[model samples]
Target: MQTEHDSTYISFSREEWASLHPSSQINLTQSEINHIQGLIGNLTNEEISKIYLPLIEYLSINMEAAKFSHHVKNQFLKKATKNPPFIIGIAGSVAVGKSTTSRILQSLLLDLPARPKVDLITTDGFLFSNNVLKAKGLSERKGFPESYNIRALIDFLSAVKSGEPCVQAPVYSHLYYDIVPGQYHQVCQPDIVIIEGINVLQTPKQVGSSIPSRVVSDFFDISIYVDADESHILKWYVERFKLLKKTAFTKPESYFKRFAELSDVEAEGVATDIWNRINKVNLEENILPTKYRADLIIEKSSNHQVDNIRVRKN
Candidate 1:
């Protein structure tokens, strides 16, 4: 890792970080890790035992402390203590493995002693529908901050933190590239909630006096940001796009179906264009700026392995 500590974070090499803990108490198998892998990256069971297992243990420690704080506050108020879901926000640039990290955390969290009911939600579900974006002239900016229903997202998270029994989040479809109308993913009272997205750490653009100034991260008990060089992420994005052409894009109803027939050279050109035009802009302007706000940052190597970890000290 680059020379340590020019910032609020304390950085450690993967081995150093792993050595901080004697061993991972969690028993996740290789096949289980494969099942949670995302489109662009692969993770082995060893990586999990060394990196994520320690992180999971850290989160569980925080969860217990939060529960205790809640109990203390309730006692001060002479009210009954209620354990709310511990919310974690996972933010990173597209194709940098945030989805895989979220899924892995959700899986590990389930085995915690609390046997927490963990629910993973992607902020893609909060994006404005393509029709709405088109009407607002933000079709090309779909992944940008303005393309999300910020108010609705905040309200949903607020309700969840308030211990609401059930809440519905809009469903988004990658194949259709739009929100699935009238479809909602119901989240019951989970013990833990992981909200994953490129912009989960972002502050909403100020609209008017009617909206609160709080950001989505305000509801998080802890947050993680997956980190990698921009060059590496761009390459991953292109690679994923190429893979999608052979997979999802081959479906007749896939919005990216046209890409399925493109030659390898043609597909590379298109992926490069899309990255340069859209995803790169979003990453540079929105996503990267929020990385420092995360409580823990996991830096990935070119091979998509967790190479370093930085935990914020202050």
Candidate 2:
């Protein structure tokens, strides 16, 4: 039988845990299980099993903990108050597999019997329109925090926290490199809402002596940071860029369509230049600085496997 680790004390090594379960037993149907198996080639069965099962268990436990805390607080106040929906923030450097992690977590959380209604939202949708960026002469700094409409993001979160029946968020297109007009994703009241982004844990910019009203982290019941060495991430970013150039960039409507026409040598150089100029700079200035704010950190090995998980003590 699986047992819950004590909240105040938890210790386990990857090797010891792997020895108990050499392979992951996927609970999904054959077809779905096959698809996942295809995605993570050669990963130990144990690693795959632990990926979702333990994750779902951990999240469920945390949600319950949040509820108990709220109950105690309400009792102390001698008044009734609605417990806000649990919000999770996921942050990582560019090309550090954050998107993949988010998708996996969403799937795991949704599969949980107790928390089947889980929603996943990405900060990409909150990014300012391309025209707006051009007008402000900030097109090159596209992924920076300033390029996003902070007020809109805050309002969306506020609505989610208030238990709104339906909230619409914009959808962004990677091929077009812009927000698709009139294409909004509607999120209903979910048991959990996962907000994944490169800078989700960043502190809110202060206006005056008064401490900044509320940083995005204020809304998060839990936060996770996917971490890896800078050099490894840079290499992954460049490789992913090359893959995109062959795939999405070939589309006529893609902003980077011209990249598809470049020779192999030229493409590598272009990918490197973009990594060094834009993505790397954003990683250094905006993303890396927020690492300490995460409640949990998943450090990736060179092979892109999660080798260590560091959880902040309460």
Best by lDDT: 1
Question: Residue 198 lDDT in model 2?
Answer: 96
Worst 10-residue lDDT window, candidate 1: 1-10
Instruction: List lDDT for all candidates, in order.
Output: 0.89, 0.78
Candidate 2 yields a Cα-based lDDT of 0.78
Give the TM-score comparing model 1 with the true structure, all chains together.
0.95
Query: lDDT of model 2 at residue 241?
Result: 75
Best by TM-score: 1
Q: Candidate 2: worst 10 consecutive residues by lDDT?
A: 36-45
**Models, CA RMSD each:** 2.0, 5.1
Tens-place lDDT digits, model 2, residues 104-215:
7787777676646778889999999999999989999999988988778888999999888899989998878899999998988877889999988888775456555767
